[model samples]
Structures are given as C-alpha cells and as structure tokens.
Target chain A: MIGRFVARRAAMLVATALVASVAVYGALFIAPGDPATLLIGGGKPPSPQLLAEIHRQYHLDDPFLQGYLRWLGGMLHGDAGQSLTYKDSVTHLVTERIGNTAFLVAYAAVLIIVPGVTLGTVAALRGGFGDTLVTVVTTALMAVPTFVMSVVLIWWLSVQWDWLPAYGAGEGFTGRLEHLTLPALALATAWLAYVAQVTRSAVRAELASEHVETAWARGVPERFVVRKHVLRNAAGPLFSVSGVAVAGLIAGCSIVEQAFGINGIGALLVQSAAKQDLAVVQALALITVVVFVVVNTLVDVVTAALDHRVSLEGTA
Target chain B: MTGSPPLLVVDDLRVDLPTRDGMRRVIHRADLTVPAGTAVALVGESGSGKSMTARAVLRLLPSRARTTGSVRFDGSEVTTLGAAGLRRLRAHDVAMVFQDPRAHINPVRTVGDFLTEALITTRGVRPRAAEAKVTALLREVGIADASRRMRQRPPELSGGLLQRVMITAALAGEPRLLIADEPTTALDVTTQAEVMAIIDEARAERGLAMLFITHDLALAAAVCDRIAVMYAGGVVEELPARHLHERAAHPYTRALLASRPDPAATAEPLRAVPGRPLSAFETGPGCAFAPRCAHAQDLCHTERPSLSPAGEGLAACHFPAADARVTPQPGARSTPHGR
Candidate 1:
C-alpha cells in the first residue's frame, strides 16, 4: 500500500510538472509584447543594434528550442532566471515572500481549522439550537467576501480598537503573528464557514446512519458513538475538502495580502504582473501550481489513510 | 423462591408516536412475560408492532416515541429508568439483536473491532480479556477459522456470517434477554437454519431468554417455545408452538396457517388474505382486522376484542376455533405450564 501511494504520487507530480511547463511556455510566447520591446521599453521601434543587444542579453537570439531548453535547464537548478523589472532572480524574490505567506497560512489554519470543524461536529450532534445558530452564523459569514472581511477587520480591530499590527511582518515571531492576524482572519472567515457547513452535514449524515443506530443497539455510550464512530467516519470527506481549502488559500491570497499591504507571495505575484515581468510571473505561477499539487497530494494521502475504500490505482 | 424470576415482564404497554397532526398509538396495550432461559417468538406481518414491542422492552425507542406502561425486567420498572440507568440495563441485562445484520455491524469496522468495542464498553472487559472473550464468542458462533474472519469487515463476510457476528456481539455483554428482530430474514434457507441453530446453541449455553420477532410462523413454530401472532398492531393469538400449528384460533392466525403452501393439497389453490393491513393512522372503533377477517361478524366489525382464553391459550376473536379445544399432544402442556 505504501509503495502504491508513493508510486502514484510520483506519477501525479510528473504529470503536474509537464502541464505547468506547457502553461508557462505558452503564456510567455503567446502574449502581445515581444521580449525585446519589454526589455528596452522604447516608444518607437527599437534600433537594430538595441534589439540585437536585448536578444543577446536574454539568449532570445538563439533558436526557439535552444532558448526553451536553456530556460528548462535553469528551472531544474532551482534558478528561475532573472526578473526583468526587479533586476533579481525570480527564485530569490518568490522564496523571500513565500515564507511570510506560509507563516500567515499556518496561523490561520490553527485558528480556524480545529475550532471550525469541532463546532460543526458539535452542531450536528446537538441539533436544534446549536445547529441552527451555527448554520445562520456561517451562512452570514459566507455571504461576505474575503476582501470585505479584511476591510471590516482592519476598520474595527486595527484602526478602531488598535489591537494588532495592520501590515508587514515585524522583527520577531510574535510580531509577525500580530501583523498576520487580521489578514489571516480575512482569509479564514470564508474557509471556516465552508468547513463548518461541510463538517456539520457530514457528521449529521453519519450520526443518522444505520451503523450509528446499531452502535446504540450495542449499548455503546453516546460519547464514544460520536467520537470513534461519527467523527472518524465523517472525517474522510472533511480532509479532502480541507485539502482543497488549503490549495485555494495559496491560489487566492493575492487580494487578501494586497488589502493588508503584506509582502507575501500573493502581493509579490500581483506586483510582478503589473510590471509585466514574465519570468517572475511564470515563476510565481509555477510556485502556486506546485503548492496546489502538493497540497492536494497530501489530501489524497490523508484520505487514503482514513478510508480504505479509496484505491490508489483508480485515483492515479 | 430460589428459582430465577421471569427475565422480561411487560404489562399494559402502550407506545404513542407524535406526528405532524397528532399522537398515534404504535404499540397498544401489550402484555408479556419471558421466563429465564425460555425462547418466545412474536410472529407478525410488517407493522404488527413486533419490532416496537422489542424496542419498548429495551427502552431503545426514539425520544419522540412516548411509551407509557410497565416494562419490568427482573424486578425494576424499565420505563421509569433514566438514560444512564437504561444504558446500564442494556449493557448488563437486556441486549438486543436487530434485523438486517449487515446494517447492524458497521461496514467500515472489522468484526474484531465491533466485538472488542461491545466487550470493553458494556462488560468493562480489559483488552486482553476482551480479546479472549471475542475469540471464544467467534468460535461459539461456529465460524470456522474464527480468528481470520475476525480481522475482516462485515462487507467481506456473507450474510450468515454477519448475523453470527451480530449474535456474538450481543453475547459479549452477557445479556439475559436477547431481542432478535428477523435475525434470519436476510439469509438463505440453509444459512438461516444454521444461524438459528447457532443462536439456539448460544442461548442454551448462556441460559438466555430470547424474544424472536418474525413473520414466518413455521420458522417460529420450529424455534420458539411459545408463539404470539400479531395482526395490525395487536397480538390476536398466543399459544404454545404445537398449539399455534394445530389450534390457531383467530381468523387472521387461521388465514396465515392456511396461506402456508400445502404439499398435501397438490391440486388446491394457495390461500392468502385479500387485502393489506389497515393503516396505523386510520382511526377505528371496531376491530382493526375486520376488513380481512373471514369470520368477522357484526360484533367483530363493531367492537375490538382484547386477548382472552380461547382454550388453553389466548385468542382475541369472539369465537375461537370449535375443534381447537383438543390439544395436539397430551403431554405438551408440561413444557410451558405457567401461573
């Protein structure tokens, strides 16, 4: 089983890499601006001498295959070539901003994931008042977009109450946590609402299942019934959804990061896009793709661990 | 005084289910007693209140189900017991085996896990002790290579094997009264007999009282010491196994007996009751079985009759079978003679 999972994951990663490479190459080649014009940025047509210099600088003067192979080789070495506007390596720029985003994601996950899922389970078990209250609260939160939530939190917690830092990671770990809190909340609000709904519904379905009634017939205590049977059985779907939630966070945090002025990967991607830096943009997109692939892969692994019904061969 | 008291005693039991409109009685005024180590069958068609009777005995009915009547186990009134008290009762005194054994065992859980769970929780058996008990139970249920089968999930096991596992799980708590609701309905005939034999062996070995609920009268006659035939929501007749076959007094019971395919009557058409049972929600001042009872009269159609002594046993009809007074076996009365 372990061998099968490892083999499947390896195959999936290869497929994902091949697809990402195609997308990266296509986005750079098919866009309106040529590399020469973007590199020099002259209003009129560039002089032949300047154009030649630009082509030579970027190795674009080489054959298409040669240029593509050279770029692919650089990627294999973890060097994503140089950013056109920043005058730095795309790899270095992504790495620096990625750590800050990772920190923010970790904090939000801690705050939201555990309590959110637990509340959903509780609401499902104790239906009437608790379930209705949770349903209303989560639905209301879901209606508000992440940016809207960020702005509200900024207005109330940061500006009005002056509670936590509004932007950027400060010196220490604790300082970074303070700065990341609002943006993390903004991101977590939507995900938490979704998780709560999923967990509650799954738990309710499991609780009403014939197996649960049979468990009760066996005289198993209500608590053990809820924990060992209900939670364990319902957790498979919850883990898969949460995996998507994490991937969504990586792909979607651009707006949230920008709203808070945090120099995270999302904000960096947006900055690189505005400057039309293809290497930085391609590199950032590649990182996001890797994050999504790896996150979903881990989700599959967790789902396989929890549910014996999932077959590695079939999924692959 | 030294002898064991009745294991399960139910008197004037009533269960009402609340619906959107109003309260409707599900099980009406049922009274029964099962002596220690005795097996009694509650035979009835669907919606005959047999399952409800079993559920009422265990206090396992849903919260919306309002049960108002005496359900005494050993000596205590079960209806008045608190949730914790009921749980203790279920764990130690009266464990129930449900219908659809496949659904009874968790599909995702292994047979060993279910066995161990009941043992540890109900009996307070430690892991080592529970494992030993589980192994013994599997063997006792006649599962060949029991240890290997224990490692498999219910889905991996056949229907018969799953039912045996259910019996084993029920036995884990060492319950006195085992309420089996159509335990063999899902199995083939051969497997059903085998499963029934296993249950008999287990019950005999443990000196357990059993309430076997089923619609098959012949199967009930083959297994039970006494049979109670339910029609609509009430038991129309109660008698010993032989008496149920030879002296079935109620019109519904007679219809059920005649409906059984007769090998002797090779040319005669099979007999069946004409219509479905009356709806539970349909209110009536008359007999619920009047529409289907061939012997129903102005009295049977206008007034409901409670169970009364027809001959040696109870029948709910105004007129018992005239020829049913002669007991089939002269010595048969010795088996179930009671106060």
Candidate 2:
C-alpha cells in the first residue's frame, strides 16, 4: 500500500513538472517584450550580428518548443538555467537565497512551536484565567497582519530602541539571525496564534475523546494525561496543519523578505518580475508550486503516521 | 485474594453536570463497597450515568462537572487529595482497561513502547526493567510471539489482540483496583469470550479488584461477584451475582432481566421495557424509575427511595418485585435472563 502511494505520488510530481514546463514555454510566447532588444537597449539596437549572437548564445533564436525543451533538459541535468537579471546561474542565486530563507524559517519555527505549544498546553491545564488570557492575546495577534506587525516591530526594536539591524541581510549566521529576527518574529506572530489555537482545540478534543476519559478513570495523572495521552492522540490534525503551515511560511517569507530587505527567494522573484524576465519568473513560480505540492504530500504522510484511520492510498 | 480488605469505598457519592440553567444531577448519592480482589459490575443503559459515577470517584470529571460527597479509595479521600497525591495514587494503586481497545490504544506507538512508556512514567521503573515486565505482561495477556508483536502498531493487531494489549498496559502498574469499562463491547462474541477469559486470568493472577461496567447483565453476571444496577442517576439495585438473576428486587432490574432473550421459549416474543428512563433532572420527587415502572404506586411517585435491603438484595424501590425470574416455559433451554 505504501509503495503504491509513493509510486502514484511520484507520477503526480512528474505530471506537475510537465505542466509547469509547458506553462513556462507558453509564457515566453505570450510575453510582449523582446529579450534581445531588452538586453542590449535601444542604443542603435545592437547590430543584427550582435542580436543573432545573443539569441544563439542563449538558445533564444530557436523555435519556442526547442528552446523550452533545452531549458527543461537542463533542469533534468540539475541546472536551473541563468538569471537574466543578475547574469548569473539561476541555481547559485536560488541556493543562496534558499539557505537564508531556510535559516529564518527554522529559527522562527522553533520560536513558535516551543512557546506557542507550551502556552496552549498551560492554558489547557490551567483552564480559568490563564486560558482566557491566552485566548485574548493570541486572538489579537492573529488579527494583525504579518507585514503590519513587521513595521511595528521594526519601528520599536530597531528604529526606536536601536537594538537590532533595521534592514539588509546580515553578514554570517549570527548577523543574518539578527537581520532576520524581526521579520521571522512578525511571520511567527500569526503562526504562533494559529498554533496556539490548534493546540488548544486539539488538546481539548482529545481530552474529550473516550480514551482520555478512560485514562483519567485509570487514575492517570492530569499532567501525564495532558502530555502523553492528549498531545500524542491530538497530534494527527495538528501535524497535518503544521505541514501545510511550512508551505505557507515559504510563500509568506517572500513578503516578509521584502519588508525586512532580505535578499531571499521572495526578493529574487520580485526583482525578476520587475525586469520582466520570463524564464526566471516562470522558474520561480514553478518552484513555489512544487514546494506547495511536496509539502501537502508530506502532510498526508505525517497525518497517516499519527492516525491509523488515514490511508496513504486514500490520499493518492 | 479472597480475604483482602475492601479496596474502594464509595459512600453517598453524587456527580452532577453544570449547564447554562443549573446543575443537572447525574449519579445521585450512589453508595458502593467493593471488597479487595472482588469484581463489581455497574450495569446500566447508555445514558444511565454509570460511567459518570465511575469517573467522579477518580476526580476525572470534566471541568464543568462537579461532585458532592466522599469517594474513599483504599481509605483515602480521593476528592480531597492534591494533584500530586492523585497522580501517585493513580500510578500505583489503580489502572483502567477501556471499551473499544482499538480506538483507545495509541495507533502510532508500538505495543512495546506503549506498555514500556506506561511502566516507566507511572512506576518510575528504569527502561531495562520496564521492558522485561512488559514482555511478561504481553505473554500473560496471551499474545503469541510477544517479542515480534511488541514492535507492531495497534492497527496491525486484531480487536481481541488490542484489548489484550490494553489489559497488559493496565497491569503494568500492578494496580490494586482494575477498572474495565465495557472492555469487550467492540469484540465479536468469540473474541469477547477470549477477552473475558484473559481479564479473569489477569484478575486472579494479580488479585486485582475490578469494577466492570457494562449494559450486558448476562456478561456481567458471568464475571462479576456483585452487580449494581444504575437507573437515571442512582443505583437502583445491588446484589450478589447469584442473587441478581434469581432475586433481583428493583422493578428496573426485573424489567432488565426480562428483556434478555430466552432460547428455550421460542414461542414468547422478546420483551423490552416500553419507555426509556426519564432524564436525570426530569425525575419526579419520588422514585427516579417511577416513570417507567409498572408497579409504581402513589407513594413511589410522592416519596424518593433510598438504598435499603429489599428481600435478599439492596435496592432503591418502594415496591420490590416478588419474583425476579420470568415465568418458565416447558421447553425452556436456558434461563429467561441468560443471553
């Protein structure tokens, strides 16, 4: 059953790749601007020899299908093509940006998971005043947009207090962390709210399940009941949500990257789009789509692991 | 095992749930005493609140639910104990095997991990020691190839196997009182019997006092030493297992006994009580069962009944039934009450 699911998933991924390649090929045809002239500018509009040389060099002079095939073939060979904006290999540009985004996501994920889950659990355990307080705080945080939160955080922490860097990707890991901290926290603000809410609801639902009642009847400690029984059993839905949230984080990071002036994938896509670079824009769009699909697939696998009721075949 | 002191003493216990309007009583002043190592059954219908009464004794009631009166487990006032004390007591003195073991067992965990985690967490046993104990427990519960099955998830096992594993996990703490709440409800008849045998074996081996809650009076009769019949929010009857089928005094008990199918009397239609028990808050000033009782009198409606000795058993009834048995037919194979 697992093998069948894996095979079907791999097939779906291949289909996605095919569709994405076709879309990218179509995009070049539909785009109004001519890349050859755009590259050289209107200063005597580069001689036909120079234009032909540029087209031939980049494989742009070939028929659209042939050119698309060449690009797709390069992808198969682990090449993401060259970026028209930066005049550098797309792979190098994407890799550096991806690393920075990954670090931000990792640190922010820890920030949200550790505190958000703990607060949720404590709220569940201490039901009356504590729960109400958490609900209020998380609700307020949830209502605020991430970008708006970023601006507020920056003004207070960087502009007003001058504690951290206000803009630009920092130097090393420590420097990058300092630069990414504000935006990550702003991004995490919404996620923390979501995680807290999911955690609270899931824990409460599990606590109400017959099995938890059985555990209580057996004299399982309230703490153990909440920790071992409730959390683990309630984890199925939360695990799936967390997986989807990771995908969302990647999408949201683009905006956060702009707000924080981090030279990440989001910034790259914006730069490529502003320059009307069809190849780079299409590549970035397809990469985002692939990320979403892969994350959703991982969510299915995680949920299946947590609960026997979910069949992997059913997901396929 | 036979001569041990009473393990749980529940006296005048009342569990109530709070709603928007007011408190709606569930278990009403239920008093039950189970001798150590004895099996006591709390038999009731789906909403009769038998489960609620059991939950209150352990302080496991939901936040909105409250309990009045005392629950003394092994001479400790369970309600009065602090959180830490309750945890200690739960870990060392009591354990529960639940209904629908398939859903109760954590699906992601291996049987070995589930049992070992319980052992280490509750008993504070080291991992190595816990593993050996878990292996023995798995064997005792009749799981063949214990080592191999130990690493398998709950879904990989049959319903009977899962129940056995739950039983084993319950036993890991060596609890003095074992609470099995309709533990075989989800199993097939054959598997049910096997599960019962496993439970009985474990009970005898450990001399654990069991509170077996079920709606199946026949199954309860088969396993329990004593039976308590709960109706509405109160226990309507309590009697020895032998006396229940023969001399059940409460009208509710008699109706329940009559409802059981009789294979011998093929000509007679299966009899069931005509109306359901009134809602907990809907009970009249008198007997809670008066609404459904054929023998209810004016006094039964006007005055509430308490647990008093009626004929050979303790029951809450204004008018106890004279004959608990069904009028026997000539070709009767099994007793009218035996299913």
Candidate 3:
C-alpha cells in the first residue's frame, strides 16, 4: 500500500514540476522586457544590426514554443542557461545562494516546529491560564508582519545591543548561524504562531475525543494519555498544517532575505526579477514549486501512515 | 452472590455539574450496590444519570463535577481516594467498557497494543506475557484468529468485533468489577445479544461484579440479578430483575415496563410514557417524574419521597405499590422480558 502511494506521489511530483516549469517559463518569456539587450547593450542605443545579432545568438528570435522546449531540453541535460544579470550560469548562481536559503529555512523550521508545537500542546493540556497566555501571545505574534519583525529584531538585537551582524550571510557554520539567527527568527515568528494555533486546536480536539477519555478511564497515566492518545491522534493534522507553514516560510524568506541583505535564493529571486533576469527567475520559481509540492506530498504520505482511517488506496 | 457483602456500595451519591445555567445536580443522591459476582443494571432514559452514577464509582466525572456523597468500592472509599489511589483502583480492581467501541479505542493503535497497554504500563506485566494474555482473552471473548487480529487497527474491525476486542481489553486487567456503560448499545440487535452473552459468560467465569448501565429495561431484566430504575438523575426503584414487571413499587418503573414494545402486541399502538424527559436543571422541588406520572398525587408534586422498603426492595414513591395488588395483563406474553 505504501509503495503504491509513494509511486503515485512521485508521478504527481514530476507532473507538478513540469507544469510549474512551463508556467514559470511562459510568464518570464512573455514578460515585458528584453534580457539580451539589457545585458549586451547596457541601456545604450546600440546599432539595429548589433541588437539583431545578439537576439539571434541568445535564441530570443526563436518561436515561443521552440524556445521553451529548447530550454526544457537543456534543463533535462543539467543546463539551466546563463543569468543575463549575473553573467554566470543559472545553476551556479542558484547553487551558491541555495545553501544560504536552505540554512535559513532549516533554522526557521526548527524554531517554528519545536517551540510552536510544544507551547501549543502545553496550552491545550494545561488550559485555563496557560492556554489563555499562549493564545494571547500567539495572536499578538501573528499580527506582526515578517519584515516588521525583521526590522525590530535588527534594531533591538543588532543596532542597540550590537550582539550580532545586522545584514549579509556570514562565512562558516557558526558565523552563518549567528548572522542567520535574526532573519530566521523574523521569518519564523508568524509561522510559529500559526503552527502553535493549529497545534493547540488540533490537540485540544484530540484531548476531547473518546479515545483519550477511554485511556484515562483505563487508568493510563495523564502523561501517557497525552502522549499515546492525544499526540498520536493530533500528529496527522499538525504535520499537514506544518507543510503549509513550511511553504509559507519559503515564500516569506524573500522579504526576510532582502531585509537581512543575505545572498540567498530568495534575495537572488527578488533582485533578478527586478532586473528581468528571466533564466534566474524561472529557475528559482521552478525550484520553489518543486519544494512546495514535494513537502505537501510527504506530509500527505506521513499523515496517511499515522492515521489508519486515512487510506492510501485513494478511497480517502 | 446476594448473601455476600456488596463489592461496591454507593450511598446517597449526588453529583452536581457546573453548566451554562448554574450548578445542576446531575445525580440526585443515588443509592445502589453491586454484590460480588453479580450484575446490577442501572436502567434509565438518556439524561437520567445512570452513566453519571457509574462514572462517580470510578471518580471519573468531569473536572467541574462535584460529588457530595460516599462511594465504597471493595472496602475502599472511592470519592476520597487520591489520584494515585484512584489509579490503582481503576488499574487493578475496576474496568469500564464504553458505549461506542470504535470511538473509545484509539484508531492509530493496533488491537493488541490497545488491549495490552494497561497491563504492561500499570500492572508491570512483561510485554510478551501481556500479548499472550491478550490473545487468550480475545479467544475467550469468541474472536477467531486472535493473533492475526491483534496486528490490525481498530478501524479494520467491525463494530461487533471491536466491541468484543474492547471487552477483551477490559478483562485483560482481571478487574474485580466491570462497569459496562451501554456496552452493546452501538451494535446491531444480533451483535448486541452476542456481546451481552460474552459479558455474562465472562462475569460468571471470573466472579466479576458488574454495574451495567442501559436504557433497555427488558435487556436489563434479562441479564442482571437486580435492576435500579432511574428518573431525572435519581434512582426511584430498586428490585430483583425477575420482579421488575410483576412487583415494581415505583410508578416510574411501572411506566417504564408499560412503555416497552412487545412484538405480540402489534394489534395495539405501543405505549409510551407521556411528557418530555427532564434535564436535571428542569426538575422542581418535588418528585422529578411527577409531571409525567399517571399516579402522581398533590403530595407527590409538593414533597419528595425518600427511598423506603416496599415489598422485596426499596422504592421512593408517595404511595408504594405493595399496598395494591397488581394482576398480570391478560394478553401479556409468558416469556420473562427481553426479545
């Protein structure tokens, strides 16, 4: 059952990636700008013959379908074309910045998942004062935008206290962690609140379910009731919502990355888009789409595995 | 079993729950007992506090629920027992089978895990030994291929099978008293009979005391040694199961017996007790059932009746039926009670 589910998901992943690639490629292709002239002519009024030659050389003169197919074929063969803005291979540009974004997102994921789920579960179990406090705090946190949070953290933690770097991706693991901390925190604040709220509601619902009551009636300890009955049942919904939170985190990273002046794919995407760097933008958008699809698919598989009522046979 | 000292004695047990309105007395000074190796059925309609009385026995009421009366289980005071004491009591002495087996059993867990969890966790039984015991218990409850069934989760099992599995899980602790709160209510009629039979056999074989809660008075009469009829959160009559139809002293018991549909009486419309069932909050100062009672007098409406001995058992009624002779109806079926 699990094997078939994974196979189906893999096919879905490939199809989703192809569709996303087409959309991103088409959007960038038809967008109002000429990347070849922008790069080769450098905003000057170059000779008409020279501009024509540049367009031909760069395959800009090719028909839309032909150009897109050629790009897709090159992508299949490990080539992502050259970035007109950076004057480098799109793959190299993305690879260099991809690590920084991955680090930032991974760091934010830990921040969001750990404390978010913990506080939420605690709030649900303890209720009353603890529950009220968590609800109030998470609500307040969610109201603060990511960029606003970034600015505040930069001002408070970096400018005022001078505790860490305010901008840029630092070298080495420790330095990167130190530099990434504020941006990740800024990026994660909203998601952490969201995940906690979801977890709190899910866990609360599970706590009220008959299975938890049965466990309590059976003389299972309160802790075991929460662990085996409540948490296990709540995990499916938590995992599912966390997938959406992860995609949100990735989307929000562009703003956070720009705020921190970090050379991550998020920052690269924003800068390249502004410059109309179609190859770089298309590549980054395709990667983001793939990641979102893959994460959501994994969440579905894991949720089905955890909950017996959720069938892998498409009945669900 | 009747001569022996009761395994559980609940004396004037009152449970008040805080609701949106106010503190509503859900169980109104209920008095009942379950003797060793016997089944005592607490029969009532919904909201009649039969389940509340059962929950009170285990100190398992909701957090806002406050109980003001005494419950003694196996010589230990249940209401006063601390958390650890209550845990030990529930773990070693009492087990409960809820109404819906599918809802009560955790869906993510396998049948084996659900059955053996309490044994391994609370009793300190070895996992292998617990598994063996669970397998045997499942078989004893009439489930076939118990070992293979153990690996499957609750959703994989039919309602009847899951209910049997629930019973097997309950008996895994070898509890001295089993509290079955409408254990067979969620099953079909045939499955209900089969499950009840399994419970009856288990009780006889283990000498387990049982407090059975149900709305079906006939089923109660069939399985239990004694029946306690509840109305508006209070038990109005207590009598031997055999005498429930013939010697019932309380008017409410008579009404309940009359309301039960008989297949042979299809020529006549079924008799139903008049008036809506009252919540605890809706009861007045007098008898809660007075509004619906055909025999209710002005005294029954103004003053409550305390339980007193009437004929073979206790009943709370302004005028006990013992003083009046009750002849069996002419067309009444000769069979004892249940279909």
Q: What RMSD, rounded to one decimal, does every model reach?
A: 3.7, 4.7, 3.5
DockQ of each: 0.52, 0.43, 0.75
**Model 2: per-residue lDDT, tens digit, B152-198?**
87878899988988888888888888888788898998899999999
lDDT of 2: 0.80
Best by TM-score: 3
Query: What RMSD value applies to candidate 3?
Result: 3.5
Q: Candidate 1: deviation at residue A272, Å? A: 2.0
Better of 1 and 3 by lDDT: 3
Q: Residue-wise lDDT of candidate 2 within A42-148, one digit each (tens)?
A: 65857989888877877776787787778878876768777766788887888878888888777777778788888887787678998999999999998999889
Clash pairs detected, candidate 2 = B264-B333
Q: Higher-DockQ candidate among 1 and 3?
A: 3
TM-score of chain A of 2: 0.89
B55-150 in candidate 1: lDDT tens per residue?
888776777788887889998888998888888887788877777887767776688988899778766789888978888878888887888987
TM-score of each: 0.92, 0.87, 0.96
DockQ metric, candidate 2:
0.43
- Regions of candidate 2 where Cα sits further than 4 Å from its true position: A1-15, A40-61, A77-102, A214-227, A234-239, A290-316, B1-5, B204-207, B324-339
lDDT agreement with native, every candidate = 0.81, 0.80, 0.88
- Pitting candidate 2 against candidate 3, the one with the higher TM-score is 3
Model 3 off-target regions past 4 Å?
A41-43, A312-316, B1-4, B323-326, B329-339
